[model samples]
Target: MAGIYIHIPFCKQACHYCDFHFSTSLKYKDELLHALVKEIKLQKSYLDNETVETIYFGGGTPSVLEADAISLLINTITELHTVSSDAEITLEANPDDLDDAKVKALRRTDVNRFSIGIQSFFDEDLLWMNRAHRSRHAEASVKRVQDAGFENITADLIYGYPLLTDTKWKQNLDKIFELSIPHISSYSMTVEPQTALAAFINKKKQQPMNDQQSAEQFTVLMDAMADHGFDHYEISNFCKPGHYSKHNSNYWQGVKYLGIGPSAHSYNSEARQWNIANNAKYIQSIESGKLPAETETLTEENRLNEYIMTSIRTMWGLDLDKLNSIAKASASPLLIAAGQYFDSGWIKQQDNVLYLTPTGKLYADNIAAGLFF
Candidate 1:
């Protein structure tokens, strides 16, 4: 019913396109660990005693932590929460960090799923992204995890960058297929403001990201995934049947979850809160036994719009019945708003479930926004 997301706010190095809150230093790691524990204890009741079905370690790079550190956090959650016996525990890891020793060590922990950041299979592309791992590390780490007996795994790939030609993009997609990775989470490259990629584009040191290139690559990605028999469960994620990322699916389904660590966000049905992005400030506040987070109570409109945006992106589509439950008489107006999309052949309704046509998938965000309350 609920989940837990612990952000590991440290990375080995900064990637060119990354804007996530992380430091390249490990100096405050021990203190940060203690602070995370304190934050966990302090926020135990955030989920209202809901049984935790998933625990995800996402971040700057969760693999940077030793196995014992990972185990300690899991143990703490178990002590406070009635976690499901078969809960999905995922760790977002970097390829280079998943060497033989590291993978073996992680096997001792409760982490049953791996979300490896493989990004690209080409060394040139990897260098362009300033990723810490090499092409060799990218391929080998997946094998290492499989060899170590982990079945529920997913890998991330990035496309639409200037360095990734259509041919190279196909190769990257083919590589994941060849590896038999059951679940894949891919995204088009975006240059967020203030990141190195954005600065480079501003200075003309790097070409700006081309939206056309991204769109083409995304289309190609969807086709490839469908051809490979992977389910297009969500816009950015695909999986062999029944292999969806439980934690992320919970997120999209509006399940309540506690977010631990700096800059992590938490949500229950009523309100949402996020921890401060500064590690020092977060640690200071938590050490003082204060939760270093801001809270936002959800307005009916906010909740309605959020559901519309997330649910419409899935293959299951948005259910009109669920929409009306949030605010009575909401779906009738929504169907009226959707009349244009239906006329354009972009959406089709079946048994009150609004589904996006393949063409509509390209403009899903626009359609969702247009239908928002």
Candidate 2:
């Protein structure tokens, strides 16, 4: 199965911690959307006729567009590609954008899931993050979506920020339980270089993120999610049974997908490609009958290393047989390197699968890097 990811590169306002490509101005919204549709048509054959199982509208905030605009894009995709009837179409939205009218409009379209960006349920945290929506708006938006019969929902929450105490973190998870949100994606805040958060910390205007606090809160999250019967499907994602994110799961499982729009990335089994990050240049190139993207063919080592990086972060762990199939010579070296982690109880090898223990998950990146081909 295959998937499609459309990046709507516009937001109402920039969040302090964000580094994703986006424009605060909506002056070029129409032109950019048209370019997106054109891009979709241009790259229709990327998936090699595999049925599209998921269509994700991720971005600066897909909710920034009207439902009709979203519907038009879905219609265009369905017309050009063979999509599954039960495809998971998800739209990432900000809380303030999902009013009654907007939700009603979205219901008329093919979208069946909503990944709301309600980073925190507290006004103080929201303000600190420079989010445009208030805490109340988040609650109201979830209620509105549920009232409108959209139950396939997930909300994002941030933890380990200087402002987020353990008590506050529990409250955030409690709020999700109270609302009966079926899926949750949570992350410990990290300071990416050049982001406003990083700048603030650099200037001593904001307290830096504490790794100890993040690790503690992550353990708290795992416990809370377990109590709520949410499956810890991935390092950062928890979902109800049968409600895992198909799009992202496909990504981890190495299913091919086509990414449309600026800064979007696409991968087939053979190669990976990414569109130019500049909105103006992306649109200009598309208008001139060109795709402003760079492509790289995956080497055997690249494929093996990528598999280790992504698979080790998921519940599925890493498949040694799959690794051997990709790079026979590299597998022994990886296994030899992984012996240190295995001896330390950070990773467990069962049959042919190498899975991380809870302790290893905190250092997932480091462990993966150590085992890289």
Residue ranges of candidate 1 with Cα displaced over 4 Å: none
Error of 2 at 126 (Å): 0.3
Please give the distance, in angstroms, between residue 40's alpha carbon in candidate 2 and its true position after superposition: 0.7
- Across 206-245, the per-residue lDDT of candidate 2 in tens digits comes to 9988899999999999999999899988899999999999
For model 2, the superposed segments whose C-alpha errors exceed 4 Å read none
TM-score of each: 0.99, 0.98
Report the C-alpha lDDT of model 1 over 26-108, residue by residue, as the tens digit.
88899999998888999999999999999999998989999999999999999999999999999999999999999999999
lDDT of each: 0.93, 0.93
Q: What CA RMSD would candidate 2 show?
A: 0.9
| Residue pairs clashing, model 1 | none
Indicate the worst ten consecutive residues by lDDT in candidate 2.
323-332
Model 1 residue 56 lDDT score: 97
